[model samples]
Target: MGINLQKGQKISLDKEAGGGLSHIVMGVGWDAATGKTGMLGGLFGGGGGNIDLDASCLMFDEQGNQTDAVWFRQLRSRDGSIQHTGDNLTGEGEGDDEQIKVDLSAVPANVKSLVFTVNNYTGQDFSKVANAFCRIVNGANDSEIARYDLSCQGSHNAMVMAKLYRHNNEWKMHAIGETGKGRTFEELLPQIKPHL
Candidate 1:
């Protein structure tokens, strides 16, 4: 069980069992939205189609400068602190479509923040996506800590979903469901800057 988070919500990464959370996993999932059928559907291959959503994490130093990125193009960070499970071409799974595991204790000291993002790799806008969600979990116990869902339909193809950052010597997760356009992380960088 986890706290169902809304856009702009923030939670401290303190463990309930009493110590700092050493490992955390960020999970993102989504499915294609059901669209019009009949003539309109026929025009677009009958409405049902796979949505390829790519989950990515960008690490930033104290100055909000990106220091490392973990995505399909690069599976792991330079310091091996963050690792993307793999790419999910279709949002057909029951749980997280893509997972990015992070060893909080292993993260470099200079790295002050980590932003998690998702982009439509197939160039489809989020109006074609449904049930899209982003979550954080305590890896050691496999317990969900917080989750955010992009429940509304939109025309954008990417989003700066959420961020995990160090504050007051503790980690915190912020729900930043900001919509943008990009097929990859590089293209989304500019949009992400304002959110930093």
Candidate 2:
């Protein structure tokens, strides 16, 4: 929906053309410096991880103002997304949960809307307390495309933004909810350039 792809431009999942790419997520909001600060599944080596819950996500438009258009969605499982809870933050979980999918039939039928974020995380000592989010389960029955929230302040690094599409017609989610005091992601790129 929020069209803008150039950082690698390769959008063909070619699974026989029903659609191509479909999964890629990167949420960074909770850092104490580097090493473990809190929660992330069983710990060390058990074969399953990711669960740094702090909770916070919002989207209101009957009167609430704080819009930031433009979007990003690299979710798969046929848009119902069902994998990669990797959660690495500063421990490096392979390209940080490499989420880069969008094969809604190659997404060029005049896309609609898509954007999300919660960019913050630095861990090593303390300062903790962060919130994160991710959801895109529509059609095939998973139906969820709206769990946006990016709480604000307490910077260790911030860039929490959100926006999803298909208003009145169907799907919806417009979030600027919070988080972007500018710290890393390159000073949150001028607060994400007015949501581009």
- RMSD of each candidate relative to the true structure: 1.8, 12.4
In candidate 2, which residue ranges exceed 4 Å CA deviation? 1-57, 65-87, 95-115, 123-156, 172-179, 182-196
- The backbone clash count of each candidate, in order, is 0, 37
Supply the global lDDT for candidate 2: 0.33
What is the alpha-carbon RMSD of candidate 1 to the true structure?
1.8
Cα error, residue 151 of model 1, in Å, equals 2.3
Q: Show the lowest summed lDDT stretch of 10 residues, model 2.
A: 7-16
Estimate, for each residue in 52-127, the C-alpha lDDT of model 1 and write its tens digit.
Answer: 9999999998888999999999999999999999999999968899999999999999999999989998887877
State the displacement of the C-alpha of residue 171, model 2, in Å, after optimal TM-score superposition: 3.1
What range of 10 consecutive residues in model 1 has the weakest lDDT sum?
Answer: 11-20
Candidate 2, after superposition: displacement of residue 169 in Å?
1.6
